[model samples]
Target chain A: MEKEVILQYLPLYREALLLTLRIGWQGVLLALVFGVACTWIRQLKIPVLKSLVTVYIELFRNTPLLVQLFFLYFALPKAGIRMTPELCGSLGLGLLGGAYMAETFRSGLESIAPIQEESALSLGMTSMQALRYVILPQAATYSISGIVANVIFLLKETSVFSVISLMDLMFTAKDLIGMYAKTLECLTLLVVFYLIMLLPVSVFGSWLERRMRRAEFGA
Target chain B: MKKNQLIAAAAAAVLGISLLSTGTVFADEAFRTLDEIKESGTINIGVFSDKSPFGYVDENGEYQGYDVYLAERLGEDLGVEINYVSTEAASRIEYLQTGKVDIILANFTVTEERAEEVDFALPYMNVALGVVSPDDAVVESLDDIGEDDQVIVISGTTAETYLVKNYPDIKLQKYDAYAEAKTALENGNAAAWANDNTEVIAFAIENEGFTVGIPSLGSADTIAPAVTKGNETLLDWLNEEIVALGEEQFFHADYEATLLDTYGADYEDTLVVEGGAVGTVETEAE
Candidate 1:
């Protein structure tokens, strides 16, 4: 690999990395909101909304991100639902991430024993009170590892945002390769930048998982 | 801990040695010569499967276009079968450099930047940048483009380079595929789409409600075949073949066979380059 080319393109890769982080975290935030909402709906047995959540989760989870992105960027504009590339990218990532996040949270919520809710209810606490005070905290601990995995998964998915022309790290690498034909140098830089963006999240994820396990299990 | 350190050190040394050996393998001869290609009995030729008129796959799943026609002839004369490799604009150079394909006939416009990496053969066609936009808001010149409006371009094309280099302030929405760029223009996501004049002209003719407002944007350039750098046998043969075909006006026939239906008669003289020569016919006609 050519060290000079990698050094020269470092600033460009840095800019792309920042954009990726912005979009990735935004998507993860949206995913959290959507996942919690959907999980509550399913848990509380809300009428028509529960089935809709089920369908939404299945649909987004089943298809590839590339197809969803193409439909959003190209097909949606035909129906007068035009969006900027950045908006389209974050929304696509969010929608796809939401489904997985909901599934993860549901599994975590299911792991809670029914007796905990029963005990809180018999103690004169309302169902909402029981859920807020007795159930969600434990579920949040259980879901930590899954949430971290989903966040990293969504961040990696940002690589496909280049199809809609958002100038992410992959786009920058490809554009450099096209213009200069320095494949090895550009690809090496791509790997280094992605590791820089993802390694911290991955490390923190495992740390958080370990801490949550220890806290709940009484180390 | 001391034993662990020794194991880690040994692993690192093994990895370092392996990487050095692979580096030496890469430093050896990288490209295939003409005789080598003949011995294989098949030459891999890269062409765009989406960019119609120049290179594209037809409804029958057969490759048909101006470049494909020339590629077929090259394969026939070399007594080898042709292996058509579909290439994207950005991947064209990568394909050549990696020996993924022996030649790229992807309507590749020759430029100084690319010439440093790949050896270009004689010219087969002439091209210049053009802007195609909605008839209502025709982009007549670069100065008329609105500040908020974006112009679409395929990634790695000369139009993208020219606009980014000269008109840095202009917003560009770049796609990796011709079909995607066309779709973007149709969706009205951009004010205009800039590409080779030949492609934009064909787009205007084939599709309704669009016009080639800026018929020519930058300096005229030639489109040619490109091979891996230092592949002198193939390069020399291509030059000779082009000069020989000039005597028979081969490219004109190629135009008639593939491009004429899309480009029509008026573009015949201006577009086709017979026998590696540029501007000769126009000068003679004048």
Candidate 2:
């Protein structure tokens, strides 16, 4: 790996990094919204909508993000539901991540004791008030680890955006390798950039998990 | 205690032997000579399995096209069975450098930059960059490309290099595969597609509502077989084979057999190089 080549390609990597962060954050935001909404519907036990949410979670969880992106980008254009590559990429990530997040949130919600709801009702709190004030705060703490894992998974999934010509970091690395045959240099830069993007999230997640555990157990 | 030590020695010997055997297998793959290939009884020739009329797989899963026709003849003369290795546009050089394929015949256009990486054999066909676009909004020249319109190109191709260097103002949407680039064009994701003249002409002929608005965008270049950098024995043999094949007008016959249906007679004289003689055809084409 030559120093000159790494220095020269740094700008391209920088541009790709910005694009990746933009799409990744947007996707994670959508995923969080979908997760909370789906969990609320299932918790309320809505008649038809609960079954529909179950079907959606199963469908998205069973299929890969790559197939979903291909369907949205290539196949949907035929049906006149065209979306730009960036939109398709984030949408695919959001839909896939939502299924995993919903499951994570549901497990957290299920862990709450029945006495907590009963106590809230005896205290004259409505069911909605109990869900908002009593259960959700506890569930957020319980679900932190799983939510962090889903966020990291969705961010890494942005690598496949190159297939739609979105020019993410992976695409830039591949294009440089193809044009110049600088495999060692391009791949070294790729690993470094990905570490730069992912390590912070991992460290922060660990810190948050420890804090939540300490607060809950008081030991 | 003695028995345990003896068993340990035997296990270490087995592991050493296995490692040495694997090492030799890798050593043999670094580079192979003409004689080495003949001894193997199967020579791997890399060609494109997607780019139609030049190198592509047909309905029966058999390789067919202009490049494959020549590859078949080379295998026949060498008395070895041909092993067709499908290659993409970007992996051509890496395939030759790594000894994954003995010869590459995937519409490989010779350039000075590429020649430094791999040794190119004598010329068989002449080629230049060409641009194809939709008929309703034809792009007659580079100037016609608007600021917002992107030109589609395959990654690592000569067209990509030329456009990036010469027409810096033009935006390019690059794809890794020909099929994807074609799909992008069909979907109207770009204003025009720039590729080899032979390919663009073939596309314009095959697909309706498209025309080759700009023919011959860059300097004329030759298409030839490529081998590893220092494999003189194989390189010499390929050059001699091309020259000898020229004696019987082999490339013209190849054009008739594989390219005639797509190109017709008009492009026959302009494209095919006889007897590895690129100069005569180069001048006439110019």
Candidate 3:
């Protein structure tokens, strides 16, 4: 693997990195909103909406993200939806990540003692106020690590968007290999590039986990 | 009543904006004409990014090849900035059909089914199926294909079509991109690789101990620039451009500049179609 080839294509990689982040993060933000909302709905146990949320979680989690992405991109266009590649990618990630995030948040929410909710109610707090103040704060602490892991996975999943022509980092690296036929060099560079992006997130995840642990345990 | 009318007008405006955002769903807006592309000051032309001697990028990261040279010429003649959209053999027609590219110069072979999906300009080059194998185990015919041995092909390519139709029993390893197909061939994962005759020949010449045993497998086909079906204005312009390009023997020049290293002088005249004007040699090269 030549350093020169990687260095020469740095500008191209930078451009692709911007595109990948744009696609991944837009999906990440949407997933965050969807995950939090769905968690609340699932916890509330509304009749029909709860069942619908169950279906979404099961469907997205069970199926491959690539298949979902392909459906959103290629299949929907046939039905006259005609979303652009970026929108399709972001939406796909949002739906897929939302499913996984819902489960993560569910576990965190489940881990909290039920007595906390009862205590808030005893103190004349509304269910909404109790959830927002007492339950949610603890759940956030419980699920911080899982949330970080999900976001990182979501970022990596955006690489598959290139199959639908979204031009993420993997797509650019594949194109470079196709152009130069330097498979090893370009792919090695891609590995390094992804590590560069994910390392900080992992480090911060551990730091946040430690801080959250200390806060919760009073240590 | 006035307040009601204002509310109705606001609703109508919202609906109109929503329609405008997803308006391309309508079939009419699925394709753009020459006028529209010219108005935009850029023409998105699909060309190969990895296939050497046709359309490939150089060490400088700039797109170059025989097809790239032609597309550049077309862009110059039309006075539009050519935004080169890299494409593969399987995706060329879809690229045009979906309006991702206004034109495709990606070593696209003129085929009846493809012609139904996209309009082809006059031929600029020629192609046929060719198979390359290791020198020790050269495959001269389909009969030479072993029961378990696989022939590697890039999906969506004519060579894949030819092989599947003629020799259904042969195990086939398919890849979508040239890099993967070539890598599969190099890895000895497959007995041989079959592709465009020009590509096979070039590959054999470039790589030692590889030979184009079946140099010509399918009927001769012409390579042409293609636009979306019914894109007559652009098609006519491209046809004219090809004719104009031929006046200077431009394809021969393209061959010398881009293809000479791989194909040499002997294959130049046979491979170059020269804008449908010169009909000298049949595409079957020995």
- lDDT, candidate 3, residue A47? 97
Preferred candidate (DockQ higher): 1 or 2: 1
By summed lDDT, the worst window of 10 consecutive residues in model 2 chain B runs over B277-286
Grade the docking of candidate 2: incorrect
Put down candidate 1 lDDT per residue, B108-142, tens digits, no spaces.
Answer: 99888888878898888988999999999999998
- For each candidate, report its DockQ versus the true two-chain complex: 0.39, 0.16, 0.04
Instruction: Please provide TM-scores, in order, for all candidate models, with all chains considered together.
Output: 0.90, 0.86, 0.56
| Cα-based lDDT at residue B49, candidate 2 | 94
Chain A, candidate 3, TM-score of: 0.93
Q: Which runs of model 2 end up more than 4 angstroms from their true locations?
A: A111-126, A129-134, A215-219, B1-29, B280-286
- Assess the local accuracy of residue B278 in candidate 3 as a C-alpha lDDT between 0 and 100: 41
Is candidate 1 or 3 superior in lDDT?
A: 1
Model 2, position A150, has a per-residue lDDT of: 94
Q: Could you say which candidate leads in DockQ?
A: 1
Off by over 4 Å in 3: A1-219, B1-29, B278-286
Name the runs in model 1 displaced over 4 angstroms. A1-4, A115-126, A215-219, B1-28, B280-286
